[model samples]
Target: MHDRPAPRPQAPPARPPAVRRHNLGLLLGALRAAPSSRATLAAATGLTRGTVAGLLDPLVAAGVLAEGEPDRSRVGRPGTPLVFAGSGPVVLAVSVEVDGVDALVTGLDGQVVHRSRRRRDHRGLDPDAVFGRAARTAANLAARTGRTVAGAGIAVPGPVRGSDGAAVLLRAPNLPRLDGCRPAEHAGALGEVPLLVGNEASLGALAHLGQADDFVYVSADVGIGGGIVVDGRVLPGARGVAGEIGHVVIERAGRLCGCGGTGCVEVYAGLPALLGDAGAADVAALRTAARAGDPAATGALARAGAALGTALTSVLHVVDVGTVVLGGSYAELGTWLVPAVHAELVRRGVATGPDVAVLVSPHGRAATVTGTARAVADRVLGEPDLLLAG
Candidate 1:
């Protein structure tokens, strides 16, 4: 009868790959949050001990994790600590700013193993040159560390589109040469390593995920950029350009912006705008002037702060995130900027019981670079299978 349909080879058991992936993610997340013994991982992940052991076997064999000596300090039977394998896998992080490119190699535990920075004037910066330098630096670092580079993340001072493997730099008005630069195409030195390109501010915000779950990260540099975190995740938006706060029009017919917008916040709140010709050659000088009560510097900062506050008030109302972290140059100017932002928030923010907190980033100027590395580390940790594949 119709060749008996070859006994219809009994369909394989319904083993959903997603469930396995979710369990793996849970166990890995527990370990990353804090090194834990198999028992602890099982308890934390709500997976049975056998399941935890089963999952750990492949990870340990793949060098993604390691078991340490039994902890004799425990009350009951001692348990061996599970930790990320130090020599297992690493990620290459590249931060491309207006004036420099920083390459960092970071471990899964968020430790920076090696780093190199190349400084240059970005007026007519060459994308190929920057990519070449970053790739060389990554290659050298990988060679020295002897750790497989699982992935790479590039933090650009502009909007990036698409995934890590094929990122496109949409626009960097400050560094016009980087426009349309797709870093993935130039990463020959990184071999077959996965690549990710993201906005510097967004990555900076990602770096601070350990601090709070919901907050707005404002990075004021040559131009202002922002990263919004809501519900414990960075909001990348539909176009991955959700945090272009600099372009928020604060003035109806204000100063012209490089993005062809008038009265944009960048025109007033950016470092250059705050500096103007106020006799301050750099951020330090600008800070000194503001600290010394120089009218031009302080007044400029006050105006910028007010403008920033106005924009942030609108942002806070929409996002409703209570915390605002001033990063990059704003971190340096927090003394003068926070108060203005606070005042405006108090005046304009929703009547939610006074919970707003604005603070300077302790990560300092390296926040972007550190965040880039951390982002890569996070990706690898979230998907340890990548290490196995590598």
Candidate 2:
């Protein structure tokens, strides 16, 4: 037999492959947060100025970063600042919803360079077919941009329970066909670019940064999913189901839900439930009816808001998140539901007027897509070395 080489021993100070990747990620993340001089980057990343320069030079040469004039405002001798390249690569962000799929390409600075939507019925379609179409649509959009596609992020209507490479959709009642399917793979949908997959509401909450550091985001659609964020970070929980409040029991003996439960919050607050009860075609029709003083639509929305509040109260008692931000289809008609939701929260002592109250996402249904952009950007930022290699 050929001689076998002995295993290498653990070394100190010298960075191995993992350590180098970690430091690269740290430096890139700090740069993404804000443009800074090499000295500031060294301080922020806890690396020596020499080390920082050694790492930052390659990125600047690769068109991933650009140097700006030194900031003379600082106390000591100022160094030239570094910023993300203006016309560099962009992230291909995609979202797969129950109704349709939307895709957009955004720069590292979070500017939307291009966006498109495939408006068609996705419900009941084969999971492989739907995901294939989505992946191909995203690829086409990125190609049209004619810019480097750093990576991609896909937000699904279910709890994701894995890493970016091999994520699995745990359960999706609305898109039942996607249950237990890997979002990146279907009948051959995974693409050449790196991919990141996350729950839609979770990503929405991630994108909800700067609005409220601590709040509960309600992604109201065919099913209502809650995303709990504390100190600006989402709580994914033990199994990626932290904010799944759709099954919270609200009415002891009420209507049966699709999850085989009776009186669950979804049976009352879900878009399908609300629309069926109000006899409206969709949120737009419901809004028109409510604005025209139609009792059926108004009454249906009122009950849904109440049910939403009740479900949130149970979660609030434990999480104690004081703010509730509504997104998805809910934003289209949030005004009609906010009052009742606020009233119930007040009655339950979980809310106290303007200080702790309901809010609406300005991005509305687009929140998930924007959030996916952020995620994909981070994915590339974390492994910037790969971006240059490709």
Candidate 3:
């Protein structure tokens, strides 16, 4: 019997509280864009004035929001502006890269309040040790700023899954000790607060969200990874490992990669490879050598760029995205590497888009941490009752 397509699994309706949170998210989003009074928010969100006021009043009372004086405009009667509370609430976001860790604090108005980084070789180290160091960094920052950390987001150098303050690091070839680690659990050891763990490249791409409608964010660093954004949002594929271009096989029997794969893109294009090939102690030295017309440094950049181009062609064949944004260290080194990437793309006949752009993110090395802060900050501010309620 054809049995009516199994009744389409009867979707459950959203409860009233759930509906309220959704509306609050909309209102918070509008207010975050720019502060406005109840009337203006209602018009922008298509919600009734009563609904906006009802939802906003409690937030204002709870110090999540504040009312400002009338706008000083000459053309019309001024409306009292409603704004995010200035003093206390903030988000702590951290990114655990292969080389080290970086943490940043962002306020409700989307300003980075404070940031700190620890540069070291974190590869093959214990995950708990690294997380402990990160937690301490966060705690010290909190003490310095005295702003309550409303939420936290952690970015890891591999695939991850979960939400609402909990996630598991599925695999981390770059940082082997982090494999199967629970980032949120460690974050909880600090205290009770919301948390999010995401792939580093994905979060890094998020920092440049408004830069382009569709582009691939290439986070070239100690480990190379890609984050694909299509139609203005990140295209996180099934199992959340959509943009793992670092593991792409380029040269058979070549250098072994952290992922246990030989001749992968990362082994060819990652920072360590570039640095080693140029015989430079660090990025600064490499840049200086290149500026002085050092062949080794210049050649290293070109070879890395070529490897990146080869990796990207696989992405373009399937995704049809045009622009490729060099993020992380790539942004800083774009002047030396971009031409080779473009030349390689042209060689492959894949630089076919009308605009055909390869851009550098303005955030530079801070993209991952900055993006994570922005994402977690949105959650804390959007869901007042869940995160901000006493």
Among these predictions, the greatest TM-score belongs to: 1
lDDT of 1 at 23: 85
Query: Which pairs clash in the backbone of model 3?
Result: 165-195
Candidate 2 lDDT (Cα, 0 to 1)? 0.82
Off by over 4 Å in 3: 1-19, 97-100, 119-125, 163-166, 231-233, 236-240, 250-256, 276-281, 346-349
lDDT of 3 by residue, 1-390 (tens): 111111222454444987898999888877877888777887788876767777788888877789887676724656677898777588888888777779898787677788998896887788777777787777678667776778888888888876445577897876777888887676644577667778888878878766887988888776777788886566667676678888878888988887777988888899998899889898889889989999999999999999988988777777887888888788878898778887788788888544468888999778989878877876676677864465
lDDT of each: 0.79, 0.82, 0.79
Clashes within 3 Å, all models in order: 2, 0, 1
What TM-score goes with each of the models? 0.91, 0.83, 0.82
lDDT of 2 by residue, 153-255 (tens): 8888888897475888998877788899988875244357788888888888767766887998888887888788897667767676778888889998999
Model 3 C-alpha RMSD vs. true structure (Å) is 8.2
lDDT of 3 at 239: 76
- lDDT for 389 in candidate 1 is 73
Question: For model 1, how does the per-residue alpha-carbon lDDT over 1-390 read when each residue is reduced to its tens digit?
Answer: 011112222553454667777788788777767888887777777876766776677889988789877778777677787888888787788887777777788777777788877786666757777676667766787779988788888788788887576788898878777788887777678777777788989888877777788999999887889899886567777676788888888788988888887988888778887788455789899899888899988887788788888888778878888788999988988999988888877877452435988878888767887878777776776676666676
- Ordered by TM-score, highest first, the candidates read 1, 2, 3
Over 4 Å off, model 2:
1-27, 39-52, 69-79, 187-190, 238-240, 293-296
Best by lDDT: 2
